[model samples]
Target chain A: MTTLDATLDHPRGGSAAALLRHATALARRSLIKTARTPEALLDVTLQPVIFLLLFTYLFGGAISGGDRAGYLQFLLPGMLAQSLAMGGIALGQNLNADIEKGVFDRFRSLPVARSAPLVGAVAADIVRYLTVCVVMLGFGMLIGFRVQTGFVPALAAVGLSVAFGLCFCWISVWVGMLVRTPGAVQGLMFLLVFPLSFGSNVFVQTSTLPGWLQWFVHVNPITPLVSTIRGLLIGGPVASHLVVTLAWMAGLLLVFVPLALRGYARRA
Target chain B: MTDLVVRAEGLRKRFGKTQALDGVDLTMRRGTVLAVLGPNGAGKTTAVRVLATLLRPDAGSAFVAGIDVLKEPQRVRRRIGLTGQYASVDEDLTGTQNLVLIGQLLDLRTSDARRRAAELLEWFDLAEAAGRMAKTYSGGMRRRLDLAASLVGHPEVIFLDEPTTGLDPAKREDMWGVVRNQVTQGASVLLTTQYLEEADALADEIVVIDKGRVIAHDSPDGLKRRVGGLTLRVRPAEESRVPDVLRILDAVAAPGTSSSPDTAAGARPGAVSVPVTGDTALDIAVPALRRAGIEVTDLALHLPSLDEVFHSLTEGVPAKELV
Candidate 1:
């Protein structure tokens, strides 16, 4: 009989501790992957900045009644909200690509928590969301957009957007798990994200839209998130929009987290 | 009782209309290699997945390293490492980073994980490429890195699914050497492969499966004997001496075995082949042909190759006999 090496018998900690350790290890893997392939970060870094400059320069004058500065103030919050909504799609695409490459099978065979890969992937994506928020804010500052509600609320606004972004990614994770290909995940996410981002008040106010489209714009979850961020960064009502946005975040997590996990269990 | 590192009985799995595995049974003892040999879609990979606890069998029981796979899959996972068909290392991470990641996931401390990663990289001859991203490595290097990742935890059992399926012949041989080293280090391996030579080279026992069922299980030589014993080929120097050669072969050939007199007009025109029972046939035929005044160019004893055995076992035998 062959004897195994003593190093093979290293002690394993408790299950919860192991889960946290494994999730963190996987997160490190994602970060290394991002570092090596910085091109994957372009969506979060360049896309948001491009969208911010394009939307502000192209539509600011008309939307703010010839006052480009005032329009940028109104547009910055909505652009941040739109970027948050789009950030979840990157998580979906990454998950889908990992599945296609069969790395998830390797992860599944490990002595780690079943949810570690999903949770770790979504957690790692927070870095991308932060990058998008920073770039958007930094660019907005260059375009005469100021945070009127002081520094603490400005930080709070970024924190809220990230939290909402994390919650919304469960939907992307579920779609990624259910879909057959990364291309399909991209297409499906685009279909959902574009409608939610555009149909909301991200670009134009709800009252400016026709009556039929105004209903969707007013009720869209992105609308409350954008409204809440605007209230936090610039001068506006914060209480109702913040409450509704938090509720929407809670609702998304409640519905999509289990569904995504279940789908992963079946598919992976 | 001998210690069995892997055991599965009546394992069945289905994918909607396709029966991936039906009543498959396998056993592998400690520190030995068991090759599940089959063609594509023959349930070879399915069996590996079930025993590795990556997939649940529809109806059956499997145990790995004394842990029930279905009852406690996590326990089974702790005991097994699986190198899937596609090398599962993260493409964007460096080779060292990939191994370290797996080590950490296996619960090693940070320093220990780094030490083990370095150790495995050196052991697998990947030390030179340790700092390079896996995507930049060639297929063979990536595969070596993947195997090294699996060994970071020093699993008791390793499942290698077609480890050398797409590699060049030289790389395939390198992979075989690596697998041999793992088995020598006390890891029981369950390898799946469509290549017969791979099984013959590395496996102590080979299980032949087809259409989701275990058709035969035996040692390489044992399976070869089932199809036919050693083949004896005699080629006469002169075409006209073929009749005399045939007569010598007919006289000395083993009973109940077919002897072909080379009358066909293709390659080896003056050759005749006889299936003989054992080495004793060589003793009888060589002298008998000499006595008959027949000049022979070549007389050779050849064991049945795996290709012949596989063909006869898969296509010649009836389905009922496979069970």
Candidate 2:
């Protein structure tokens, strides 16, 4: 009857197939929500662009000792990392709002998989993550930040950033499901993400940091992610950072995915 | 389980310090409307949620169409549909989009989903606004859309929690029609409502709840009779003849059935009234009052309104119980 009808007639499949269909349908809802309220997309688009412009111009020369060009290449990857961290905050807040608005009540009553709404919601935000990567890439390039590597590695960086953001999103989803109010979700998620983004190598080199902060900077989860993106986008040692970042992603999934699903189950 | 479409026994739930449901029991046979009537915070909604498989009760069990609510919620979900107090449609999506999405989620083919959506939108008088985002809809429109979404699945049992809360009189009548139509199509409905009139109009059985307990349950007319079957009232043409009418009522109506304690003055100011078991009050009083040469301006026999029935059932308890 309409464009969405194309896959509507798939032959009845088993449990996993049904779950995928439900998730895809719900993901379409989230994407439609994003598209309708263009302002919602601004968090992924304009936000990263503003961060890129502000940090590069405000402290670039001072941080790099008058070599602003070198600072752009170093700072752009960190800006991408910041976008990845900030992207999930909206996911948690929106989920909290949806829960509060009683939007999930119908879904709760339906025969669909319990995990579909949360999983679909996280899945839809993948588009937002990709948007952030592209917006940051184009804006960073326009502002003289260049990828010093081949096109394939640059594409890999985009893919890797989105994957990391998806992992980070489970933490947001868990908080969103657990917290009672949207405002509290926002505040708590910021409390979680703020430290991860700021306490890492996103702004300055970990070696240049004071002794007490250096340890946290090295172990800070965002540090490895930023270092990995940097290695992928520029010519550097990608293997170790890549391994550490992959470990962090695995840990995030192993712990938070189940935790978030449990929170969702307890919503009754 | 032979003909019962829904049943709950000893369902209990507590929220922190508040006991929301204390052993609430309810049942309905196939193809009927069971109205769960209550005031605010009376736990009527809580009972519906537990039966709808959205919440698990603390102790007691529920069976929707003979499937255990606690053990197999998903199986129950497939056989039932729920429309909550608040409208649950996506505000960002069009009214048409919201219905189609729910239809698709329920596994209708795309063409079928859209076809179903268009049918529901037209039925709800929302076709003109089907393309508009639900956020732009009025409260009544949004509620109709929400109800439409629930019917997309055509489940055997439907739980409607305050389904007509915000509707106008005409729309409320339409909702009553919807409930009747669902029952006609072989669906049983568990409807929670604060409106006593709605229960009277639509329910085959009415359960009155208060403070998390079932205070009364019966057919609408049965409840009215149980409260006090009928009232015989008379007002004399001459104020001086009131005493004569009261005497006739006292003599003719059942002993101690006259609710009016003011024996000399009459129970209803200028009018004398007594609760009579059935048509006996009318047959006995009319002849006796006529025989006493009582000239009366007004004389009638009528069942107590549901409002009075509801008040007597819920408001104040037992100095002398009304039911």
Candidate 3:
């Protein structure tokens, strides 16, 4: 018989080192794909610029009772939370599109870890999170939203928001794996993110919300997340909300990471 | 059997009520092309998917390079590469990046991956488009990139699922050359194709499947011989005499099929043909036509093309009946 190539011939799932390598390689692929289609980044880049302007002008006066500067400070941190969540929908939509295009089938046939594609995809989405964070904060600060807590804490605030986003996008990844089409992924993620973004204290203080609506706002993970960002950026008590936000990020990773991996493995 | 690069037994998979694969077994020795020749929806892709470890069967044992495909799929994957029916290359990545990503995923270092990608791009004639996104390439170029990506690992076995299904004739011929080159490099190939001519040109052996079952398995010539060898065709001088020629041809051919002769059904103008067992049909018909005063413009006994072979295979008779 002819000799086979001196290949790895390793067991299923591969070793930890190999898994990390595969995931990183796939992450590189995701980044290159993102860079190739720079226009797809409009959701992360231009959308935040537009939304920050619109909301600051349109609702700033009404919500802050003509204290539009105060409203800008209040709205900026919440905008990070909302923008990052919306940014994740694009990740979900892209995953679904890749699945439909049979790109994942090629990945499946390769000798990589089963979770490599998902892990790589989620890791690459840090680009989106960073983009949304910078775009929102840059535009917000330009329009009179001050980071009262100084640059280090403000950097921490951006870091915290991006971390929360990185955790939250697992939901998008899982839904992307679960759905049949790219459009369906977009629609379903909106249905999930819409409630999470609006039903929380993302746009207003919890007390400002109607009493009945305030219950769900306190429970929504984005609420504590926004509160933590606000506490870091706008000089509020942060220790209690920080713990809850960290707990929520950990909880999301716990639930959706496995679900996303299993869905990726089992689904077409 | 021990030299076989791929072996599968009783590979059965069902998608709802449709049996995508039913008791399909196959084997391919090292350094040869094994064509899974079948019509659309005939379990060809299902069998390829199972063998490539992309889809698991309900009941089966499959091995690639002697590794259990289901239990040690990663080992199997290490030895095998697959290019699916659809363009599997990421449309958003440049051709060079796509191949390099696959090489890196296969554990090549960055420099080595880039080197391998460059070589493959050169080999596939994609060097000029290496920097362009795959979505910008034409269909033929995209298929070439997909095939090149699958080859990044220098796998021992390759699975090409309808690689030429949508390609033009020139492009299909290019694919055939690539398959032959891989075989020359000692890589065994399992090629699923709906084109009989492709199998004949490329495969050492062909397994013809229909309705989720292998109906015939043989070398291409053996398949044609089993379907009664050749067809006898006769063209009369006068178009009006086609019915007489059809009747004469039918009399000379065996009566395996109950297809009544039809003068109006001539696919070619003034020509009549029938599946004959061998060249004796020509010897028998020439003298008979001379005596019957039927002047013929053309009369020849030639091997049945795939259209005719397909006709006899799918004519409601079991393959064994024809054998």
Indicate which candidate wins on DockQ: 3
List of clashing residue pairs for candidate 2? none
lDDT of 1 by residue, B1-323 (tens): 99999989999999999889999999999999999988888999999999988888899999899879999887777788899999988888888888888888888788999999999899888899999888899988888888888788788999999999899999999888888888888999999998777887899999998889998999977876676757788998887887777777887676786678744336467699888877788889988888888888888887655566666777766767554
Model 3 over residues B89-186: C-alpha lDDT tens digits?
Answer: 98888999999899888888889999999999999999999999888999999999999999999999999999998899999999999999999998
Error of 1 at A71 (Å): 1.1
lDDT of 1 by residue, A1-268 (tens): 2334233333355667777788888888888778877998888888888888887788778778788888888888998988888888878888988988989898898878889999888888889888888998888897788999899999999899889999999999999999998889889999999999999988887888899899888778999999999999997899999999999999999999999999898984
Per residue, candidate 2 scores C-alpha lDDT tens digits across B86-191 of 9988999999899989987888878999999999999889999999999999988998899898889878899999999978998889888888888899999999
Residue-level lDDT of model 3, residues A62-179, one tens digit each, is 8878988988888888888999999999888888888888999988998888998888888898888998888888877787788899999999988887888889999999998998
- Please give me the DockQ of candidate 2 compared with the native complex: 0.46
Q: Which regions of candidate 2 are displaced past 4 Å? A: A1-11, B229-311, B314-323
Interface RMSD of each: 2.3, 3.6, 2.5
What candidate 3 gets wrong by more than 4 Å, as runs, is A1-7, A10-14, B232-269, B274-311, B314-323
DockQ of each: 0.65, 0.46, 0.66
Q: In model 3, what are the clashing residue pairs, if there are any?
A: none
Q: Indicate the docking level reached by candidate 2.
A: acceptable
Cα lDDT for residue B212, candidate 1? 95
Task: Note the clash tally of each candidate.
Answer: 0, 0, 0
Indicate the fraction of true inter-chain contacts that candidate 1 also forms: 0.84
lDDT of 2: 0.86
